[model samples]
Target: MSGGIHADTAPKPVGSYPHARRVGDLLLLSGIGPRIPGSDAIPGNRYDADGRLLHYDIVAQCHSVFANVRAVLEASGARWQDLVDVTVYLTDMAADFAAYNAVWQEYFPDPATAPCRTTLGITALPTPIAIELKCIAATGAGARR
Candidate 1:
């Protein structure tokens, strides 16, 4: 029991993979970035014509990434509350974690209701944005998985 989920409102994936894959009752999302849908615009970074990163804003990037994640989850018939696990990648954890955590709280709210998360500091991401998110969500009985 498997399938792929895609949302036209979300940014197209950089690679040839679906936005998320459903296996059994779970939807596993690909790494989602802050890029706007239907365009190469990233919400928090200034980039040159050659795609060089000029400056970054973790707060704006976090919001856009979460919005993208929400779009994918909804497309898969899941909600933010259905998320059970999350993995976050940040290019500079030391410099960005505080701001990222702040925006994260706005989404998850209560600590008890928040999904389990593991955030990693990485050298870079597929794009110039500072943040990305990968999530696993539980699709209830009505979902096709």
Candidate 2:
């Protein structure tokens, strides 16, 4: 629903789906990566000459992905504070967990107000990005569309 919600300011979805969809007061966002808008460039990710990822900064990816999530939420007529739950996926948990957690605390400093979170260490993602976020936000019913 929500008329195939799309955030023009955010990076394009890797697949054939809208940025988000609304069901009742909940807005469900698709997987959001740390790619730069328009170029799909992953922040802090260094690629080799053959386009293979050489290394990445988890802090940069964390900030970028969070910003991307905010864009989707705001474009969907919601705010960052409206987020109720988030599921994070990372390719290398053991290597990235501490840095990612530090970055997370920077954005969500208050545990009382921060959304419920679940982090999963996966094998890979569609792009070379190291992190991705799946979010659910609560929004009002009014759509100025």
Candidate 3:
């Protein structure tokens, strides 16, 4: 727990990192990508016969990305509502902005409770991943695990 005190009571981390760490009342999480359930390959990076990116569907990717984020939160004993702020990094903002918004609305439910966010359009990402999300959250009440 070099970064902070871990709060996860579940199994050991799936990777080389801690599941979740507590800093005061806040819990900062690592970025999450849309990787397959039991596989490390991220979705949406495959190419079609035309050499086009498969699943060019940003909406679907957005959902999967957040769903992965939700999994991390759940595994760490936190919930979506606890998220205070988030940052999204994208490969092409102009093209996928709308789709991203649509999926974000579905997950947020209420705009009032939505966390502050920053979205960036970059030329590339580590794994052809269209999007990646990192978030911060608060642990209320009996916060210890």
Predictions in order: lDDT: 0.88, 0.89, 0.71
lDDT of 2 by residue, 46-75 (tens): 888998888998898899999999999888
**Which 10-residue window in model 3 sums to the lowest lDDT?**
4-13
1-145: candidate 3 lDDT, tens digit per residue: 2363332332233457755576777778876666555665555566789866666557667877787777778876688888888999988898888888878888887877788888888898666678878788887775422
lDDT of 1 at 5: 75
Total clashes in model 2, counting residue pairs 3 or more apart in sequence or in different chains: 0
Best by TM-score: 2
Off by over 4 Å in 1: 48-51, 141-145
How well does candidate 3 match the true structure in TM-score terms?
Answer: 0.78
User: What TM value does model 1 have?
Assistant: 0.92
User: Which candidate would rank higher by lDDT, 2 or 3?
Assistant: 2
What residue runs in model 3 are displaced by over 4 Å at the alpha carbon?
A: 1-16, 48-55, 142-145
**What TM-score fits each model?**
0.92, 0.94, 0.78
Clashing pairs in 3: none
RMSD, each candidate, Å? 2.8, 3.2, 4.6
lDDT of 1 by residue, 8-108 (tens): 98999999999999888888999999999999788868778987778988899899999999999888878888888999999999999999999999998
The global Cα lDDT (0 to 1) of model 1 is 0.88
